[model samples]
Target: MARPLSPKLSPSIIAQAALDAVDHDGEFTIQGIAKKLKVSPSSLYNHIDSKADVIELMRGQVMGRMDLSGVDSESADWAGSLRIIALHYRNAYALNPRLLPLVTAYSVRDATTIGMYNLMAQTLRTAGFDSTRQLEIITVIDNFVLGSALDAGAPDNVWAPGEAASPELRAALDAGLGAPDRAQKSFEFGLGLLLEGLAREAEVLG
Candidate 1:
């Protein structure tokens, strides 16, 4: 016998519902969101026009959670800045790993997302990379960070070397697997390797 105190329909509500769907279902449909919100499909359209639109909103929502206000390419250490950015980037996406496939299929138009990439590019440029090299480094970091985010879902014993596994591979697994922070430690380790390699490559090209 009482009216609801709040309006259920809003851009942020739509985005959050879509994110929840993606987090639980690996993808979302307008129909799915409508059902979850107990609204008709036409109602969802009032807030979001297309899957792409919803995705951009969700992207912005996730990207906004990262603290990039401290990113200053002109003053920060390029490698250190990139390391911080990559870590934050990976952690943000790790929260919604199920959304990865859907988001990756769409071109990034979210301003926060674009700004993060621009910061990465600018930092690489400050490290003496040319435009082309900046693009390459960004791609490398993107691939690695995205992969690392997805990898967060893996079990603690990420690799289980079998009886037929190579001794070298088994040795490496023994050194690395079965830890609570296996994925996280591996991500940091790989990131360091990648950043170091980029620095060396930048030097060689200079």
Candidate 2:
């Protein structure tokens, strides 16, 4: 008798299955992925050593798709470069915001994602940032991008004020309540704020 021709599993296959699981449930495990793929847990183990490996692959899958259309690693317009990168970075995670927490918890050893960081670091260093400041700037960008992803994941009308809420708070919510593309507008505004503030600090600390 001939054996059934099952789809062969590889690291990318495993990563894709795991990504689907995480996207649906906000978590995944080797067993969960195996069940999703209709494969044995042992089969998954054959391709990935641990959950961390699977998550790293998923990260690459997402980051690899970033639309870095205007990024210039050699451009002197570091600020413009930052804006372009931040937009792409936020958009990438917004696709699967559920995976953001997992991606942050794991160390980023993936070359594709590291490429973005390398550009940011190089841009800052070129602008006269010391190593320590470069790290801080990187952290700031990471935090903002992650928070932006979270914001994108949040349901529309994330804030609701009750009778006890202050008129000021209620009015503030009204201004933004049901606004079009609220998360996107906020992210763009916040990115500009961060970049401007960081540019000033870089000069001050230079």
Name the best candidate (by lDDT). 1
Give per-residue lDDT, candidate 1, residue 137: 86
Candidate 2 accuracy as lDDT: 0.85
In model 1, the clashing pairs are none
lDDT of 1 by residue, 1-206 (tens): 99554447987888899999998878888998888888889978887778999999999888888997887897637889999999999999988888788888999998889999999888988888889879988999989999999999877776765797798898888887877888898899999999899878867866
Considering every candidate listed, which one attains the maximal TM-score?
Answer: 2
Task: Give the root-mean-square deviation of each candidate in angstroms.
Answer: 2.3, 1.7
TM-score, per-candidate, Cα-based: 0.89, 0.92
Q: Write the per-residue lDDT of candidate 2 for residues 95-170, one digit (tens) a residue.
A: 8988998998999988889888998888887677889988998899889998998888888878865797798989
Residue 172 displacement in candidate 1 (angstroms):
3.2
lDDT of 1 at 41: 90
Model 2 alpha-carbon miss at residue 152, Å: 0.8
